[model samples]
Target: MKKTAYLCITALILSFTLKPSTVNAAASPVQETAKTSNHTAGIKQEQPGTLEEPAASEKPAPSEKPAASEEPAPSEEPAPSEEPAPSEEPAPSEEPAPSEEPAPSEEPAPSEEPTAEIPVQLLGANAAEKTVTLKWDNVNNAEEYVVFFLKNKTWIEISRTQETTGTFSLAGYGTKNSFKICSYNSEQRQTGESSEIKVLIPAKIKKLQTTAYSKTKVKLNWKAAKGADSYYIYGKQDGKKYKLIKTVKKTDARLNIKDKKNYRFKIVPLFKSTLGTIAGTASETSYKNTEFVSMGHQKYTYSEMCSDIQSLCKKYSEYVSYETIGYSEKGRKIYDVILGDKEADHTILVVSTLHAREYIATVVCMKQLEYYLLNYNKTVDGKKLSDIFSNCNVHYIMMANPDGVIISQTNKARWKGNANGVNLNRNFPYAFKRDGSPKDGSYSGKKAASESETQAIVSLTKKLNKTQTLAVVSYHAMGQIVFGDYGGKNQKLRSDITNMYKIARNTTGYSSAANYGGTSNGNYREYLTYKMKVPSVTIEVGSVSCPVPKYQYASAFNRNKLLILREAAWLENNF
Candidate 1:
């Protein structure tokens, strides 16, 4: 019985021991496989002998909870491994997304702050004194401010400040004025301009005088009154009153009279209140010259000028060829008089009556053509007139704005625009503007290159060769002046043309009187200088007036003839 009990005990001990060893071997392979899988799945595994295993006797008690227990053991091991990797990647990605989103949201906040502040205001305006006072409300968070003033339809920076209220006084503040303010932070970021404030100064007239020079002519002078943006000189010749001339932004004024007849002169001043206000006008004392006389030529209509030109072209059929360049808005033909030998290579372009009321200029051009054609064989200064024509091609576009001239002559005192209601003088393409006027005069057009007259002139000028077309001369009336382009990018041509103009002015007595030096805009002179690079001049024929009395035309012709002859001679010699 003792031996049997001892054997059974031994067998039991061996069975338990062997079963534990087999179970340990199976668990070891399972752990090895799991560790390999975990490494492939990007989870680090521990070494095979590092982990402790429970004894076989203890394993029986934990068998019911093996899944839960095994899961906790693996999770604890992986927790530390995954913590470093996942923390590195997730922390970087999450932090960047939030940071980027915050930056985008902050971008627009700066733009919105200043829009809520800064208001511009106009305090007072006086046209008689030619001064204005401007004030504005304070802006929030503004480190500095800038003020701008409008002079001659352009905004110029006037002052800058870090304060709230500002006062600005401007002398010679004329018929048009605009004001604006800009706020800035310490960082120098400009918030944008405040609302524009506009005001018009009042008009005042003073220091009007008249001087008689000859039995047939007189001169008028005056001081530019404060707040007087522009001055209009009116004259009465033989009891018929008319606007004789105008001067812009000038103080001193002088006018010459022709014809041995009585004449009366008066001055009118224009004033602007604010930036966008209409001008107000004031008239001064009237002075008279009892010795003024009239020129004897019969008053000719625009139609008459056209008819006579046609007749003269027909009369000289062999030498002159007449062709229509285009038609005006009113459908009147824009005639071109091709003078001189047709075979000549050198071309001279002469344009007149660009401004409708410039009747005397048109008359002068017509007479020039007639004199040149009739006396080409005649010699003056040892130069044959026929030789002049034979060498150069002369193109005379006599009546440029026939429609405008018709309006000016037909009892329409306020007529300064073409049939299309565009100021032909302001219709050119160079520096053209539509809204750059005093609501009274020289409105360019609805847009640049808008007017048909401007288009026609540009087309005609562009067609002429810069080398072949030696020069261009456009004639205006009133303010006896002969001015040409200078101080431009093209120095050689500008210098040459200025010299020619000086000669013309000295010979003709149409000297420069206004301080506002020549700046060509929508005018043919500008086109000739800047675009074509050709020498050009604008000859203001006669003193300030239109129709200039029929009796005065002879004296005007006498004074201007030598100058015109000099020009013709110069063209013939130079080109």
Candidate 2:
């Protein structure tokens, strides 16, 4: 059986050589596959095959016997092929399968940075300290920040930082500096830059000014400094160290400092930075000094009178009540300084300085306030001063014609008229002479009560009439005399009028200006007397020389200081 098998294998091997044109079976029964290869020339080639099957074109005919794709063993080696075997189809590229470990993920080409759209905030600029700080809120994925300076209306990059805050030295920033900011992401991609923030460093003080509101108060004013947050009101009085009086937030702010004329002020602008409860301060460059005008002694200016009276009222606030009855033609306020019991049913209205030259009488009224306040609630004539004043509100108009008083005080003229140049005393509506030309020195204006001062008096008298006012006293300078309602007979006078004359005579030995006429012409006295029936009297103080100097204030005040008190005390019996 072994010999027969060997003979069959030999016969098969010979059959392949003999039938070269026809296909023959190979020793192995496995099917032959086409070898696929590609050349650089892009051409396909294959080994020789049977006529029935073209080289690598179509599938070989199916046969039970396996085919030998190679030629039967040649005795000699064939010409060597410079190219490798051509494959019927190119082998699939050796691509690595999807890695479970992800093959290190090629380091995911670092992601791009986020856009920077953060807004910036400028905390403050302290020029004195030569520093400027800028800040902003952190942007998501922001890796860094860039700062830009606005130059010539263009934003130029100035610096970069990783933090949200940045600062610049102010030495290079001139009077004004503008800046902006932008943020960048980890990928170096940045968002649009923030809006510009400007820093203003004020210029040094060039001028400082002051206005004397009164003898006791002064206001300091000046132009606004460039970037000042607040002004430091400093004062340097005679022989005193500089002191900060107040801090004004506004540039046009006003405040009362020292009252004395010798006091000078220096305003320094200041700015502050608030970080939690802690704060930092920087003072702006300032070296200007200013002073207020003195009006009381050096010049009896109207402003001084207003301020002085205000101070006096403040000092004796408990007993004094001041109000602006009306405004003069020149807009000067007509003040009525009321003294005694405000709730008093029996009241007295004392008016002074109706004539410009008689301004000293105003001082008398002021002294009366001081004296009365001191004597108030005290024992007088063995009776409590409070009892005397409890039902008597003494309305003392310190200066009836403030405009006229200022004119006389400044120009030294007998300016008895108000700012409109009409005689305030002759401008009253009661018995007023409308026929008198304003050109006349003592002309009663074009009509009765034509002057604001007179109108104020008229309004006050009318208001008091309802309040049970007992008497109205008008004080004048240039004549030390007492005059009362001139209507009808002197014997028909009320007992209170007679008593007032006697008191005036006994106190100052002044003569009485007896009147035969039933009414005076264009005067406040007549308006209060026959017209209103309030029992008015005119007490002429000092000489007829027009102006009574302030020097005589003591003498005049002393003579009449007790006159009002005496009359007020006798009201219960007389009225």
Give the alpha-carbon lDDT of every model. Answer: 0.61, 0.62
The residue ranges of model 2 lying beyond 4 angstroms of the native Cα positions read 1-300, 381-383, 437-440, 485-493, 515-519
Per-residue C-alpha lDDT of model 1 across residues 1-575, encoded as one tens digit per residue:
99878765655554444455534643686567866776566444443323433333244443334243333343234345334445334334445565456543333213334464455555554545555555667666678877777666555678888765666664443444566777776876766557666655544555455433333444455566655566666766666857656655575455565544555666666554333333334554443333112234645566777766755554344456777888788888887788767777666677877767677777777776665555554685566766666667677777788787787787564566777667777777777656545234476778766766667677777776644646777777767776764667777786769777877777777776345454457666776687667788877766647655556566566666555556656766665
Clashes of each: 35, 13
What's the lDDT for residue 436 in model 2?
Answer: 47
Best by TM-score: 2
Whole-structure CA lDDT of model 1: 0.61
Residue 406's lDDT in candidate 2: 77
Candidate 1 matches the true fold with a TM-score of: 0.46
Which residue runs does candidate 1 get wrong by more than 4 Å? 1-298, 436-439, 513-519, 562-565
State the lDDT at 432 in candidate 2. 74
